[model samples]
Target: MTSTARILIVEDEPKLVELLTLYLEAAGYACHAVYDGNHVDEALTSFKPDLMLLDLMLPGKDGLTICKELRQHSQLPVIMVTAKVEEIDRLLGLELGADDYLCKPYSPREVVARVKAVLRRYQPQAPAAASTTSGVHIDETRFLAQLDGVTLDLTPVEFRLFALMTHSPGQVFSRDQLLTLIYDDHRIVTDRTVDSHIKNLRKKLEAVRPEQEVIRSIYGVGYKFEEGSV
Candidate 1:
């Protein structure tokens, strides 16, 4: 876990709030609690937390609305916390820009582990020195990526995927190979998860350079990055 990483908890339940705070604090995260969704904006400004644990149900404002509104201007890491385990709700939350989702009745340890996972993905430092090749530029120290001079608003997963593929062009990587490179934690994810993320990454890159196709799929095998494509 990243020591001193601040986590904002938005939940109306007092006991759950206390429990989450206690667990996160014990894991070296600074925790702040907000009972009402309406107060989230204010707390975000004041706390400037590294990540947000947003409860789907809240007084004054709902989590979906809060997340939707927050996505308008901020890319703050968000993990939706809720008792609603419906597939649609989970998909909606992801579409709304949530970094992760956790259902109620989950262990506090699991939450801590998840928190660590999200932060690790978002905060990974550059492995060697910063460099640029082709049309891509990356600053390891700053965790910055720029394509043809435009900075990409990539999610944690997107950023990791881009960095890994760009680091070694023309090398075919199976979905399993790419998954291991992307996530340090042992979280089980289907091949569709990797494909979905790749789709997103390709879209972002294409948005900046429509004529260039950087990643190519090797049917029945995996995918690879083409250095000369861009």
Candidate 2:
């Protein structure tokens, strides 16, 4: 498909932004740039980019703060770019609602590919009737999930994992397998990243049904969904 998708690059490094813009534009996307975190809102309102490539640290507002605030009003897909390699940093970024994460020294081409993957998966599909199975209900068109009829505020990545695991019930999905489903770019994201997602997913699920632990870790193997007895 010929893409006219708009992207906002939020990076303090001018050269990096230029490189990303070069690659993204080459990949058939239109790109705008914000050099500092403070200017993100202005760009979002004026440029109306379909996606944002956000830097973790900046002069004014940090990426995490911006992401948390943005999620309050918008569900625009986000891919966090950061220099920090710590797993906790990655978890925080994801927990703050980032769609994907990229550590620094990343390939611009790969970033472009990730942008395409996230955008492709995130595109709204035809509204389907909410289907309830195994005690969970998800609306594809709405990108909404409900447990015990309580709405879940799930990120795209979280939603995909929840739906896949819930659909299979008892099937154990290894980290690699789960990563393949959530992140299509085939990049090297750490195990903690996967754990972070599972942790967040469980929290959201438990919020709705506090007594039941639907998703259980299988130690060294992976994780699976089990409809616990109530």
In terms of lDDT, which candidate is strongest? 2
Stretches of candidate 1 off by over 4 Å are: 68-75, 86-95, 122-128
What stretches of model 2 exceed 4 Å from their correct place?
A: 87-94, 228-230
TM-scores for the candidates:
0.83, 0.90
Cα lDDT listed for each candidate = 0.82, 0.83
Write out the backbone clash pairs for model 1. none
Q: Write the per-residue lDDT of candidate 2 for residues 1-230, one digit (tens) a residue.
A: 23899999999999998999999999999999998899999999999989999998898999888999999888899988778777445555457888887889888888988898889887667776555465678777777788777888987788889888776777899999998888787776678777878898888888877877778889899999876521
- Tell me the lDDT of candidate 2: 0.83
Task: TM-score for candidate 2, please give it.
Answer: 0.90
> lDDT by residue for model 1 over 100-215, one digit each (tens)?
77888899999999898888866755476554568788765565788888998776667777888888888899999877765556777668767877887888889998877778
